[model samples]
Target: MELYRSHVLVCAGAGCISSDCQAVKKSLLDSINRLKLDKEVKVVETGCMGPCDQGPVMVVYPEGVFYRRLKPADAVEIAEEHLLKGRVVKHLIYQTPETGSAALTFEQIDFFNKQTRIALRNTGIINPESVEEYIARNGYQALGRVLSKMTPEEVIDLVKKSGLRGRGGAGFPTGLKWEFSARAQGKPKYVVCNADEGDPGAFMDRSILEGDPHSVLEAMAICGYATGAGQGYVYVRAEYPLAVQRLNLAIRKAREYGLLGENIFGTGFGFDVEIRVGAGAFVCGEETALLASIEGRRGEPRPKPPFPAQGGLWGKPTVINNVETWANIPPIILNGADWFAGIGTEKSKGTKVFALAGKVNNTGLVEVPMGTTLREIIFDIGGGIPNGKKFKAAQTGGPSGGCIPAKHLDVPVDYESLTELGAIMGSGGLIIMDEDTCMVDLARFFVEFVQDESCGKCSPCRIGTRRMLEILDRITKGRGRDGDIELLEELGRGIKAGALCGLGQTAPNPVLSTIRHFREEYEAHIYQHRCPAGVCKALTVYVIDEEKCTGCGRCAVVCPAGAVSGVKKQPHHIDPEKCLKCGTCMEKCKFQAIHTL
Candidate 1:
């Protein structure tokens, strides 16, 4: 192996890529070559480094210097000062928000300190395209151990004992799913990896596939070995071009290295993987729907009684798990069931990877142990609500999940606990809402999202969610009636019970959970004829207080509706009839004069 004096690890994840981390990578390579230090230096693009708020991030190994918000121009200075002269770039160092002390390493940052990176172990650390890099991090060691020694039954038994539930929302026992497929009488059984992640703010699957494709590949192969399945398929969305490309590369390399395709590591167990592209339908996330799509049929879900385990792909038994679930498999194999089980809460073992988004200070991907409190995730790790706003609620499980109010902030996030709160741990999308966010509007937003994404396969989900959305829209628009809340609850429950698949069953989650926790907000919108957060336009009326208005003309000049009227240095009055309730006057008012009622 050739030794390099320094290694520059640049984030190439979707977030960083959007922030132009690719330019940073190009600059580093070009600079290194120009400086005639190519032989002595190595530049590698890796996955997300968390802390997306400080993106276009790069880390220098050996010294472990963390640099944030790197511009293409800053690359020369980084190369000249840090790489060549061996002096740290003080200005680029990530500083502690409270103390202002420079955080020298990635682990020192609070964003990464609270995270337990089991599924994301190799991400952001290794060059994913290189098989040798993956090998250096004990990538295929679990597969080698399983194939060389452990029997299929023993593997299944160990996972069952581990208590690792699915990370893909449903929290179903992974080992149990595998066992069903293993026990089923069938020839040429198959394993599938569900990578068609369509959740709004969710990117857990994308990160794993991009950062550590080998993990999923290895785990799927392990699953195939245990279930007597010789063929494997990774059904990924076409939207994830990067993930797809990397997965293709990973599979090709794995096959060439004898890790995939035919006999692997001299075990005589033949296994190969193929990629299936999804048309980006949200319903295809369900196992049965996914199978139909892969089979080149319409992507609609079928009723399960003959669950995929009994009758699946090409009319044979099949084992399917999401990307995050498969990513956890290899680790569970390498580290004993007890070790894996010891990490998380009872009944819900192992860490969960959440895409922390919305009005939080540090928004990015976070993986924490199962029992970690929402308070810790929001206040401690997330750095609390942004702009000094009070934390109102958090929407978990994407559109299919519920909104947990401030009272539930301390709620320990586990599969059972969240479900008890009328929320599922669906795909781990944690969207934090602040005081400025209207609960009614929030509920309406999700209802509209789900209603639009509904496959219309089942009437309960198709019609029920639309009806719920219509009611929510009416409520937000100040057209709600007295019995609207009761109607919503009834409809939500009916949809939950009657929906055919997980999508429809959980479709009313946002409305149901919000009503359960923040029913007063809904009532305030209906009875009081007011939006507490002043977010719903129909319920909000903007007015400039004459006593406080400085007549700076800022509000008048910026108002798109031309509602504000006054001369300079005099109090301005807003014409209510002409006002569109756009909130531009309030936003532009410098004297705190504009108020929304």
Candidate 2:
């Protein structure tokens, strides 16, 4: 075995790859070779580190010195200073958001210290493509334990006792779902991992697949053993090319090692998995629709009576769980059920992985205990709103979720509590909004997303979402009716009650929840004919303050609409009709003179 004195772990997750981590990696390697330190130093490509915004990130082990936001030049300097000379690169270290002080190691950064990583344990810690590294971290130990010592019934009981509800949006009891498939009379049962993570701004599952693909593979084999099946399938979306590639590699590696193929551990039991790539349909995130897509049919949700556990995948009894849900399985098996259950609240157990984005200082992946409050996630973990802006609301659960107002910041983020707030924990996409965000426009944006993604199989989701979207569109365009709010509420309620499948039922969440919390904003849009956040171009006008404006022609020079008119050193006036309300003038002005109303 080749032993290296130091290992450099570079973040090769999708975000970092787009940020040119490849170039940085090459430069680091070149510098290391140039310095004749290639024997002592090793570079390893790993999956996402939670803090994605600071991409092209790398950490030097032994010392664990963290470096962020690196260019090729920065990589070379780190290779020279830190790798060769044993000096830490101070300027490239992550600066604490609260204080401008540098956090040297991953542990020193609050973004990492605050997170409880279960689904993300191996991510950014090891090379995802290397099954050897995964094995070194006790990766397949759970599956081996289950096959050798525990019975199928015992496995189910352990999971049930763990209090692990499905992490795939619907908080269904995973053990109960497995038990249902076990008890159901069928031939050649199946285990399916739902990798169709379609939520906007969600990459939790993708990161897991990219980082620790074997965790998911091992869990599926366990599920197959528990459910009396020999075959499993991973239905991943086509959008995640890297995730799919890693998954295929993991499967191949598992098969080679007899971890996936027949007669594992000489126990006369065998399980294997295959990958099925989806065509990036958001509706496919729903289990029934996902199953349909796996069957090579048009993805559409069917009414439940015969759920997936009873009759799924070519009319055979099958157990299906999403990527995050499956990733939690190995941990529950290795660690005791009580250990898992003890971590979270009574109903919602274990930690949740959230793709934290929008308006926050630390925008990346965050995993915390189930009962962690919004304030803790936003303030302590997320570093609050950017540029000293006040937090207005947080949109959880994607299009199926409702907006949580500032008053609910202290609310414990559990399945029941979020549902109580009209937001379902739909796969952990938390978008923070600052005070400057227009609620009406935000609601409209989400509603439009839902409407566009609707499969149109059901009229309630199809026509009803369209109606609500049209009303929201009119409201944002300064042509809202007196009863538009009431009409939206009515339509939203009707869709929730009448729409088929979970998608349609939860489609009106954004509009309804925004109305429930920010009714005043809606009133301002409808009655006052204005957008309080000045986001709606039709309802907004940019004005220059005479007291602040120096009549610098900077605004006039940049205005594509040519609306600004004034002499030098004089306050400028804007023709509202000619003004595009693009906010380009405000961004261009050296003095903070332009104000939006």
Candidate 3:
């Protein structure tokens, strides 16, 4: 085996890849070869390192020096100065928000250090393409242990004791689901991994698949063994090309090593997996809809009671869990159920992986214990809202989620606590909002998303969500009625009570939750015909403060609507009718002269 003195791990996750981390990697390789440092310095492309905003990022092992926001040119500097000369590149180092100084190691940065990482243990640490690295890190050890020592019933009991609820929106007891599938009378049962992660800002599942494909494969095999199944399928969306590629590779590697296919570990248990790519339908995140898609049907939800555990995938008993939930299984099997259960709250066990986006400083993948508070996630782990802005709200669970206002920042982010706030832990997409955000407009945006994505399977979700969207549209456009707020509440309740599937049922969450918390904002929009945050173009008017206006003509030049009127070195004036309300003037005005009314 070739041993290197220093290991350089570059983030090749989808985010970093889009940022052209490949160019940075090429530069590093060229520099290393030119300097005769290839033998001593090793460069490996891994998956997400959590801090996505800082990509293309790399971490140097031995010293564990973390580098962020790298360019192709910067790679040469890191290779020569940090890799060859044994000197730390201070400028390339990650800057700690608390001290505003360089944090030398990965642990020194609070973004990574504050969270627990069971589901994401192998991510960003090893080369995902190489199954050898995954094996070296005890990747398939859980499957071996379960197959050799434990019975199917014993495995189910262990998971039950672990207190692991499904992380895929519904938080259903995973063990209970397994037990149901096991007990159900069916021939040739199936195990399915729901990789159809359609939440707007979520990449938790995609990252796991790209980073640690084997963990998911191992977990599925374990599920197959427990459920008396011969075949398993991964329902991944077509959008994740990299994740799909890695999954296929991992499946081939597992079969080659006899970890998959017939007679695994010589115990006569047979299991194999296939990839079923989805067409990016958001509703397919629901289990039945996902199963429908896997069977090459139009993805739509069906009424339950004859749930997936009883009849799924060509009318056979099946067990299904999403990517994050499946990733947790192997760890529980290896570490023991009590070990997993002990980490989280009484009802919500283990850590949750959240894709933290929007106004927060640290926007990335954050995995914390289930009971961690929203304040800790936003302020401490997320490094708070950007540019010293006050946190106004957080939108969790994508379009089906509710907005958590500033007052509820201290609420624990467990399943029940979030449900009480009218939010479901729907696949962990947490988008932070700053003080300048308009609550009414935010609600409208989410409602619009859900409305567009509705499969039109049922009238309540199809017609009711459409009604809610129309009302929200009117409210945001300064054309709201007197009883519009009350009507919205009524419609939202009707939809929740009458919608067919989970997606349809939760469709009105954003509107309802925003109304529950920020009723005053809705009143301002409806009664006053004004957006408090000045987000609604029809309700907002741009003006210039003559005292602060330097009149550099920057706003005038950049304005698409040509609303700004001013000469050089003179105070500018804005015609509200001509203004597009794109906020270009405010963004370009260096003197801080623009204000919205």
lDDT of each: 0.90, 0.93, 0.93
Write candidate 1's Cα lDDT for 458-543 as tens digits.
Answer: 99999999899899999999999999999999999999999999888999999999999999989999999999899999898887
lDDT of 3 by residue, 554-584 (tens): 9999999999999899999999889999999
TM-score of each: 0.98, 0.99, 0.97
**Model 2 lDDT-worst window of ten:** 380-389
Clashes of each: 0, 0, 0
* lDDT (tens digit, per residue) of candidate 2 on 119-174: 99999999999999999999899999999999999999999999999988988999
For candidate 1, give the lDDT of residue 387.
69
- In model 3, which runs have C-alpha deviations exceeding 4 angstroms? 550-572
Instruction: Give the 10-residue window scoring lowest on summed lDDT in candidate 1.
Output: 95-104
Candidate order, lDDT descending = 2, 3, 1
In candidate 3, clashing pairs total 0
Error of 1 at 4 (Å): 1.4
Cα error of candidate 2 at position 281, Å: 0.9
